[model samples]
Target: MALLLKEFSPAELDRIIEMAWEDRTPFEAIRHQFGLTEESVKATMKAQLKFSSYKRWRQRVEHCRTKHLKKRDDSITRFRCSRQRAISGNRISKR
Candidate 1:
C-alpha cells in the first residue's frame, strides 16, 4: 500500500476517497470542495484503495474523462496570494 504523508480522520479520508471513485465527481469538483489537486486526489486513492482498484480507476479516468481535463484547464481559480497559480501541461495560465 502507498503511504500518505499526513494523517486524516477516518470520515474525512473516507469521503475524499469515495468522491474520488465517483464518475460524476470531477477532480475540479473535489478541488472546489477540498482545495486539493488531482495529484493529491490520486495519491489519496493509492494510499487508501487496493492496487487493482487504483489501476482500473486511473485507466478509466484517462480514457473516459478527457472533457474534464479541458474543463479543468478552463476553470477559474482563487488563491490567497496576490495572484493565483494554476497550470496545464506545464504552462501557467491565470484567470
Candidate 2:
C-alpha cells in the first residue's frame, strides 16, 4: 500500500488528503478516484499527517455522518462541491 501511494505525485497525494478530510466526500469516492481502500486511505493519512492531526481526522471521520454514503442523507448527492471544476486524470482543475 505504501508503494501504491508512493506512485502518486505530490499533487495527487494532496488531493487525496483533501478529499479524505471533506465531510461530503465518501471513502468510495476516494477509492474510485485513487484506487485506495478505506484502510489504505487511513494508512496514508496516518503516515502523511502529524499524529495529532491524524487523530483529529480519525475522530472527525468517526462522527461525520456525510463521510459514508450509507450514513449520509439521501438528499445529498455527488462527491465534489457543486461549484468545483471537474477532476481529470486525478488532477483538480484550477479556476
- Predicted structure with the largest TM-score when compared to the true one: 2
What TM-score does candidate 2 get on C-alpha atoms? Answer: 0.88
Candidate 1 per-residue lDDT over residues 1-95, each given as its tens digit: 13343545576677678667666557776677666788988888887779999999899877654316454444434312344355343235767
- Residue pairs of candidate 1 with colliding backbone atoms: none
Per-residue C-alpha lDDT of model 2 across residues 1-92, encoded as one tens digit per residue: 66967799898899899999988899999999888999999999999999999999999999999989999999997877887788876766
Each model's lDDT: 0.64, 0.90
Candidate 1, residue 79: the lDDT equals 17
Clashing pairs in 2: none
TM-score of each predicted structure versus truth = 0.61, 0.88
What lDDT is reached at residue 6 by model 2? 71
